[model samples]
Target: MAFTGFGGSTSGTTDFTQELVSATGLAERDRPADLRVWPNPTPDGTFTIDAGEARILGLEVLDASGRLVRSLGALSAAPFTMELGGLGAGSYTVRLLTDRGPAVARLLRQ
Candidate 1:
């Protein structure tokens, strides 16, 4: 995430607190990992999964308490999108079962 600020007409200062906070948060989340997921805290009933060069065998959505909510088998492509229409508002775990290993990510429903 990028932010721009307009210069002041006179001598002034720019508060870096907000920018620092935002940058830290973004950096912590957007790591160069093998897998990625997005649209977390989404209400659109959809989310994406990015499995880099891994053969995805299955996908599972688990509730916050570690209960299995849904399972999908045999994904044929990378960066696949899944629908979460029936899921209620809460935190969830999206597990991508690949041939190499399981890539886990967090998801939030709104």
Candidate 2:
């Protein structure tokens, strides 16, 4: 199956679910080669998006329950700095809305 970017249904309801593993036991499609966040676990909210060679237009910070907590909005380019100082220390996931598709990574706030 192909990744449909972010999950949104025609019924007009919340659908934040995602398939962690495809039927083949791997991501349906490959993620950006270098799309990553540096300093996985950061004490401060300051973080950087590596971009690697991809163009990430937007970002969404989700809680462990897959609920969207914050939206970084659309970006003009990649390798940008994100200030999540408002978030509390805990486990979180950063969803990179890239030009190619979506990429998710674990983020820890200190």
Best by lDDT: 1
Q: How well does model 2 score by local distance difference test?
A: 0.75
Please, what are the lDDT tens digits per residue for candidate 2 over residues 20-103? 446664463465535678787878978887666667778898888888888877677667788776778888888887766777
Q: Which 10 consecutive positions of candidate 2 have the poorest summed lDDT?
A: 25-34
lDDT of 1 at 76: 92
Regions of candidate 2 where Cα sits further than 4 Å from its true position: 1-33
lDDT of 1 by residue, 1-110 (tens): 44444444455754432233464554543443367888877887688888887878988999989999999998897789888887789999988777666788889888
Give the RMSD in angstroms, all C-alphas superposed, for model 1: 11.2
Q: Best by TM-score, which number?
A: 1
Residue 42 in candidate 2 has what lDDT?
A: 76
- Tell me how far the alpha carbon of residue 72 in candidate 2 is from the true structure, in angstroms, after superposition: 2.8
